[model samples]
Target: MKSLLFHRLALSKDKKGVLELSEQGQEIQKADDILKDPYVLEFLNIPESYQFLESELEEKLISNLQHFLLELGKGFTFEKRQYRISISGKHFFVDLVFYHRILKCFVLIDLKGGEVTHQDVGQMNLYLNYFKKEVNTEGDNEPIGIVLGAAKDHVLVEYATESISNQLFISKYQLYLPDKKQLENELNKLLDDEHDNSASR
Candidate 1:
């Protein structure tokens, strides 16, 4: 029963001791439902100290497309890379484009080798607006944009995205695998806290 429930939605606890679910119950209703917060890109196998350019990162992901897709979670279908969009004879390229079968929306990803800036957020918003106005056909949902970076300033991201009407998000990617023991310890701590809370009540 738990496995079946998980097939519909994932349940986990956050640092504040709040239990969170991936979705309401059985279906993906929004972009956040399908996206991971910090995407793990350990399969790329780039060294921790290596300072790679955005283009190199794209190439590595394309070369390992299958693993990349799996890391992106379910329902993503690759559409194009360096997808071109023109404005007043000026051409801009999106790093990666994907279509979510379940969400019925185009997903645009902009890669940043360093920390994300407000300009990056603005650029992604522009891409999303263009997709909505010029690219989306009838019955398609609003396009979603992800500004992917190696690091993010949460306060800046909040300020940059707070007023945007477009469906946009900021996330980080790690080249190396996370420490399993640390994660296990955190999870165990949360579980213990929950158990103690229940008993106290």
Candidate 2:
């Protein structure tokens, strides 16, 4: 939650690169205000070696809905799994759907078993467009689409999302907790750098 707040509050970049709370952040108006990157799904308790299909993963999440909801942050209420949407005569399914009371928008999530691809992002964009055009009510805001993959190439995702207008984001999910020692070392290094700066001053 702390990490989410840090990034959430800094939605827009000024000319000088200074960070401040965005208009949306102040009102919790956008999905980015509440979404977290690299969502830690340590509670899923799936073995690292286990190779599970996307459907299997969805089942696990449904089974652990309470913990999953907590990890998803506040104001998320589960609406459905495999929520079907029809486009023309064809059909598509979103892995998970939720409603954010604060944002007043539908949250669409697509789970990927491995690295996220451009196609995955494109598909999510389609879902968002569908929801915005077909699903949103008079008072509802635009829907948010999240592509949650096991791995993502930062540069790839960055480029893929360029020029898109809808509220779309791609995030990674990990089954295990992060390395504590690595975190401690990074924190220590930051503290040491601060001390050095103070001494020089």
Candidate 3:
């Protein structure tokens, strides 16, 4: 699925002359770059523009896990929806849990209905710590945590993630699907901008 998207964009190399994708997978990108900023949730039956709660989005994604997985990127297998982990004397549930085959790591996702916060990042960080120490096996890789919010604040993300050891990320979610043709056009524009920058340098 990821290959299809890359091929359609006719991408070869970026301004840095590095392949966007290789046999291993998306190269050495930080968690933020590794994850999509505005994840499209077109699989849900909601209208193109509609108000919804975090639970609503989560339920819709769970109802259509197959489509959700596809949008989630490649090599992802659904492990558990609303996965639970016991901490201290209390039980906490992760909104979604997926395992990435190629990456060989557990992917934990937390959904936010509105703006993301430092608290959300801290919660996900705690989840990562627990998964790494308790849930993961000898061969398991360190877990990756993602906090998906309806709105994004770059400043908040930078401040919240600073000094955090976990590979945590925060990104926005879009309720509607993007037009493929429109996306292609945007890709071309990006390529053109890259070319222009390279020429200037």
Candidate 4:
């Protein structure tokens, strides 16, 4: 999750920019593996049709802390929400913070309601640096970052409000934010397609 969770295609590449995040001498592929692909949020119970604010999503996840931890895998313990840090005298806040017992690192998460930008990744990197310098202890591994984001398709979103003769915007709105099952299906399909493409290449 060090990068913006790009749209459901689960693509590591951004349509707009390249995301390179390995420290020299580090195994790049394993670094990629550090991020849980898809970072499942079925626990949040957000309907696929619902377009939500990042704050709202954060609140839901915090409320369902147990389920959220389960999705994050073992060893994650919630530290704080809206954890703050000061840099050059300016204060910055990370959305959600956790400590991974197994990884021996701080896991910083920034929630994005829409597609993630290169600037977002840079921002997370800055958070990691801040923790490395100011927060983490000498024994801790480098902090891990995740930009949990929705890789929403603009085309579908733009047309979402548009309706044919049979239905109105209200009807369309009700159908927005898909149910968990449909969302999972969509995610799996994208993963499958990506795997197929990679295999062929």
TM-score of each: 0.82, 0.81, 0.76, 0.61
lDDT tens digits, residues 110-174, model 2? 99999999999999999999999898999999999999999999899999999899989988888
Cα lDDT, model 4, residue 87: 80
Q: Candidate 2: global Cα-lDDT?
A: 0.81
Question: Model 3, 1-201: lDDT tens per residue?
Answer: 533444323332342322444444555333443566567775687885677877888888889988888777766788987788897889989999998776778999999988999999999999999999988987778889999998879898999999998889888876754568966777788778879989999
**Better by TM-score, candidate 4 or 3:** 3
Candidate maximizing TM-score: 1
Best by lDDT: 1
What are the lDDT scores of the predictions, listed in order?
A: 0.83, 0.81, 0.78, 0.63
Q: Any idea how many clashes model 3 has? A: 0
Worst 10 residues of 2 by lDDT: 9-18
If ranked by TM-score, best first, what sequence of candidates would result?
1, 2, 3, 4
Clashing pairs in 1: none
Model 1 lDDT-worst window of ten? 2-11
Error of 2 at 38 (Å): 1.5
What's each prediction's clash count?
0, 0, 0, 11
